[model samples]
Target: MSNLNSLQYFIPELFLIVAILVIIVVDLFLKKNKKIVSAYLAALTLVVTIFLAYQQYGYSPALLFKGMIVLDSFAIFFKIITALSTLIVIFISLPSFRTKAEYYVLLLIVTLGMFLMVEVNNLLMIIISMEMVGLISYVLVGFNKHDLKSSEASLKFMLYGATSTAVMAFGFSYIYGISGHLNLDVIQQSLIINQPQALPLFVAFMMVLAGLGYKIAMVPFHFWVPDVYEGAPTPITAFLSVGPKAAGLALLIRFLITLVAHPSAGNAANFIQNVSIHAPLLLAALAVATMTLGNLSALMQKNIKRMLGYSAIAHVGYMLMALVVFNNQGIIAVMFYIVVYLFMNFGAFCVVESLTDKLGSEKISAYTGLGYRAPFTAIAMAIFMFSLTGLPPFAGFIGKLYLFAAVINQSWYILALIGLLNSVISLYYYATVVKVMFLNRQENAPPLRVALYNKLLIGALLIPTLVLGLYWSPVINFTSRSIGFLFGK
Candidate 1:
């Protein structure tokens, strides 16, 4: 399709661009006291964007912008995910950030960047979209300008992010030199026809993985996660835990799909055997390291946000296991788990935000006697905690069940076993918070009060987390259909 013709399929992104500019101009006229209007405008834009994206469901997959971007079930699915995550973050952030127009503007821009990240097909687009997200993220991490930790976190995040981007760019240069192509599909065909040296190809691919892995908070590249999570505003931390991570995973899946032989091809094993590089085994090793490090480190955290940061890393490890399978079923499982993970992880962070607002602390000890003071909030938090631990009758359990089943079906028993053990190890830390809230007591503890808005939000998140555990067939079917990209549908 011509670039002009592609505009029709690109309405959602165009709308976001316009919305971002409108928000910036609108914020300039509003006084400090009226900054909430900017937030409301941002939220409305996201709602409209979500509606536009949802309308794209079931549409045939097609290349857009002269094949630089893709419009398909997969891109549409992730666009909705990013939009909904932004909307929820806005709502939860309202009470805390009453008059920060710039903060809201940066958030909208980041959301726009994420929309592009998932749809990218060209290597140049990938670098542009990722840098857009990364630059905005650095400012957001240091939004609390006067706080030392926020500044430090931003510095750490910027250094790590910059180094990784440079490494990825260098890798891209080598690929272009070898194949003379920037589009991923074109690169794949060139590599196949030219049959480049195994050593250079392996090194280039690993360097590219470093950049993608850093975005998703995968291990060794995850040094910035804990401090950044603990220092950034709580709502931003919640958004980071799910939104960009999901976008990065989508990009990874698309990139890997282009390079590897399709799982259905009979020569899949032969390709791996003849090639000197072993992509699956390498990913499997990273999965094990990420899981082991995240879980073991989480065990020693005192701050709840820092602990959840580690937990998020561990969850990425689980999702990586699905990618290692490299099949249609594996892709479906990853999507399903991401859906389940969005609610439970965000719900947990909401509780943390609310508690921090009320008690002025993120330490675990702040939760002592919470059950006696605020029974409803305590119960809801208990459910979130248990669900996160992947116990039965919760959404997280079903998510993990599908992940393990996918790996086991592919005869990856060792990876599955390690994942199961990690789940067990995670229980200790999750239960520690639960125990402090309900089982531990203080003599003179005052009764805690939860605002009506927070209670309603918590309840809203809780229902889905519980219901999906019982009847998830609809979501599973949706995910299965969404994997059409694997089959070239």
Candidate 2:
């Protein structure tokens, strides 16, 4: 009965579950008319869930379900981001995926899973939620089954996801066997006590990190990204890049701050600290490699989507550089970067979706002479590309500034310099898309028409890119407070 009483603490998740069931039931009855119902329900559910999350803002943390989950500021922050990002993705998808209603259902489940990913305190719950999210994404990636590209994307994503899951499970088994604890906090405690036996522990943790790195598409584990992104539908690609990436980062954050950074472990603690310092080096190397590789690969791509796919990988490297810092500033910078990334990446995809739907082409040359045909969209794409390349007067520039600043503050000067250089290298490819849009001349390019709903969505995203770029203080402050609140500071 006492454990049951703890239900009060799980209102956000409860609301989400109830909403999912309601949406599912509604879909069962509505048949072809189901998407409208599902969309509204999903959006309303997320809004209510966000409200519930806000209600828990000042509440003390409480463990529930036999200590498998805990509500804290960190979880709440990610929950809110998950909910909001889902809402945005649903809107973004509406114009592109109206023919496929299943996206609504899959997206809701994925969002719920991501929310759970943040709240779980135990490895079992984390694995369950992580897999739940991954499965939904696999479906979403290939939702347009008629498209051979979509099918290929789905297959590649599923194969990679399965392998990563198996690796993670294997690593978890080692962690449990070695530490004799399933709860992350308890496992951290055990690792500290067994610090003298560090080799086995480091190996165990690295395996787990390797699995997570795959999810985030970090170096050595990022090979599948561009193929999957290019092959997936535009809206689904947007969700894949932003939603899962953010969830992966949230899980990574939970693991690092709670599990690996515990102070009681002598050698293990030192190992983590060394990681904090050397992480920049590893990420710096990865950053240089990823950005150069991604850009160089993107340079040869004719498909616009594939170009963005490689660009996303390079962006991952940048985000990882911030992660390499592993401090509060770095964490806040990461969260901030995600917000900007969502707008910039989604905006770019919106343009892609709009253009493809209208022009029936995804080729880079298809954008030739498009500036005169679709002035608003071309201009928007230019802005997004500029932002993506970290140019001034855009949020991407600010995001990169803060990220580099955080890295340098940690005394990772070379990492900072490498990041700066990568940004410059990235500019060329990103500019190539812009050049085609504005400078290239071609024959027989038709006029582009955008839906009213899409125009509104694009305009809505544009406001944030401009606002956050010039006035980032509020976001930085909120994110900093959110980070401090995570560890109960």
Candidate 3:
């Protein structure tokens, strides 16, 4: 009977699957005008999933399938974020995909993949979930059918994603062979027993990191980011930039804290000693490279979406600093940063979506005189850009502050310094977008009629950016508590 309770733990995911099936049935039966029903069904499913996650909050861990799936605050938090982000994506996509039915279906599948990515404990499950999401995203990116650029982008994304997945699978197979267990906890326990194998273990770990890094678009593995971003639909680009990115980060936390840690007592002793000597140095390099590469490339971008693409890579560098700390505070800081990033980023993408639909303009220069022509969008966008730049009195600044503090607390002063310097460099390009909107002058720009849905969505998110600027304590506390549940350390 207690085992049955474990099934209840997956209520949110079960709800999502049922929602997907219902939407598919409705799509089959509904004709013409009835097609919009799928969007509503998608939205309803997301809302219900969020509600289910909320209900599960503050509960003790509920383990399922001999502990392959654990229902805890950490999973619940990511689940909620994924669901909310998907809901908003659907809303934004409705106008973006007026004629495409497959777009909504693909989105549903991606959401399923993301939900599983955050909750699963087995490495194979993680890879499978990632492939599911990656496949759907590739299709969505090229769904325009007539656009050759879109097709090219989809092909690149698929090839890159497939190669990365294969690399990760090889790494997982090594871990399973070494430890004789697929569960993360079992692997962690095995590492504790065999400390001498650190060299081989680290190699496998790096390979796995390589694959996950590609998903997050970290430096070196980030080659495919800008092209894919530029070629995809504006709304789909926004979704990719936010949804999968966050899910990937979430899984990184789980992997780093659970699977990477040594499990046996004597092995753990040797492992801990070596990690302090080598891990920080390795992460520091990643920090410098990712941020420098992303910022330098973003400076040359003509398309606003592609620029944001490079910017997202740089942003990952900032978040990566927290992970380098590898402690409770670092995890909390990263969680908080991701939460803030979702708002600031999705909000920025919303502005791009609004402008693209309104003016049919995507070039950076197209934003000139928008401050006067579309005051609300311009102001909202300016706020998002400033937030992205880590400026004062914005959520981005607070997120960065906490992340830096986490690094400093761990005595990784060098990484904290590099992260701060990157923020300074990032501000230059992020500010350029603001300058294009308000500082650059143009005459007789046409008026843009902002859709009510877009307005409501942007307006809803702007409050958090402003509020977090002044009162970030609650968010920090919630994130810290959630991280505690995640690591139990």
Candidate 4:
């Protein structure tokens, strides 16, 4: 689509851009409750943006802005995901970041970056959007300038982000040198027609994967995750855990199917036929290592946020299992799992943030006798823990079931078994959190008071986590539909 035609379909982003500016202007004048008012405005904007995104779902998919981006269901789906996640992040920020208007401003800016992250269709947009998100994230991570850990995490995050993106851009140069194009579709055609040699193309592909993997916190590229999660403000840590990670996965899936893999007849499957890389063999290795290392490391973490950070890495590995097959079913599994994970992971973090606000601690020991002190929140935390462990009658179990089934459908039975065993290993650490909360006794501990929104927010996240487990067909069908345009069906 041309620039003029693209604008109509891009209303959600336009509204967001306008709203961000308005909020900044609004913040400048207010002396009282400035951050609260700005956050409320940001949340309102996201609600409207989510509505605008839904409207685009009915629009026919198009290459917007002269192929710079694609307006499609897949992109729309992620737009809503990132926006909605950030909305929750805004509310959560009221506790730790409500005093500073810059926190809300930076958040809105990073949300814009994430919006562009999913819709990118050109190789250059990848670098542009990613750096936009990365730079803002560094600022947000270090927002608590007084905290040494926060400052340290920000520096490490910046270094890792810069290195991966530079390597990935270098890889993109090699790709353009070979394919002579920057647009994903054009690059795909060029590579298919020219049939580049195996070795160089494979190396270039891995470099790009390293960049995407780092964003999603895939192992080896995941060195920054634990520290970043622990040191950043709880709200920002929660945002980091979900928002950018989902965008990275969106880009990864689109990049793989469009540039490396070919959509099979009738858009029924995706396979790396044109590209010479052994994606399945390599992805399987990463998945195994990511999960094993995450689960093992998580078992030793004393801080709740750091444990969830490693746990986030483990969940990424689980999602990667579906991609080892790289079929339409696998795609649906990944998309569904990401949604399931958003609620479970955020709920766990929410519980931690809420309690930490009152207790001024993030350690597991602080949660002793939580069941007696804060029964409702403790129970909610237990549900999140159980769901995270992929237990029965929760969204996480259903999500994992779909992923395992997808891998099995391709006859990758051994890989599926390994994933199941890893799930068992994860159970120990997740259950340990529950055990500490309810089983360990702490006499005369003070009663913990949770704010009204925190209580309501946990219920909001909890409902979907449990209901989706019982009635997940709607979401399954929705995810199946969302990828239609990705494969041009």
List, residue by residue over 390-445, the lDDT tens digit for candidate 3.
Answer: 99899999999888998897688877887888888888888888898889978766
lDDT of the structure predicted as candidate 4: 0.88
The deviation in Å at residue 381 for candidate 4 is: 0.3
TM-score of 4: 0.97
**Number of clashes found in candidate 2:** 0
Alpha-carbon deviation at 229 in model 3, angstroms: 0.9
Cα RMSD for predicted model 3 = 2.5
Name the regions of candidate 3 deviating beyond 4 angstroms: 1-5, 262-271, 274-277
lDDT of 1 at 489: 54
lDDT of 2 by residue, 1-489 (tens): 146877888888788888888878777777674457667777788788889898887666667777788777767878888788888888877765554555687788898899888778798887899899988888888888898988998999999988988888887887788778888777766756664255555666667777787888777778888889888878878877888788888888777655456432222223354222233354557666766677677777888888888888788888878877676777888899988998999899888887786777888887887788888888988999999999989999999988998888878787778788878888888888889888986677667777878788888988898888999998887688776545446
Cα lDDT of model 1 by residue, 1-489, tens digit? 679989999898899999989989998899999999999999999999999998888888888888899888889888998888888888889888889988888989999899999999899999999999999999998999898988988899999999999999988887788779888777766766666777777788889899999999998899999999999889989999999999999999887765555423322242333336677788889999998899999999999999999999999999998778777777888998998899998999989988897888899988998999889988988888888889989999999999999899888999999999999999999999999998999898888888989889888889989999999999999888777865565
Score each candidate by Cα lDDT. Answer: 0.88, 0.78, 0.81, 0.88
Q: How many clashing residue pairs are found in candidate 4?
A: 0
Our model 1 lands, by Cα RMSD against the true structure, at 1.6
Local accuracy of candidate 4 as per-residue lDDT tens digits, 239-286: 999999999999998788765676442322345465677778888899
Question: What TM-score against the true fold does each predicted structure earn?
Answer: 0.97, 0.93, 0.95, 0.97
TM-score winner between 3 and 4, please give it: 4
Model 2 worst lDDT run, 10 consecutive residues: 262-271
Considering summed lDDT, which 10 consecutive residues are worst modelled in model 1?
Answer: 263-272
Q: How does candidate 3 fare on TM-score? A: 0.95
- For candidate 1, what is the total of clashing residue pairs? 0
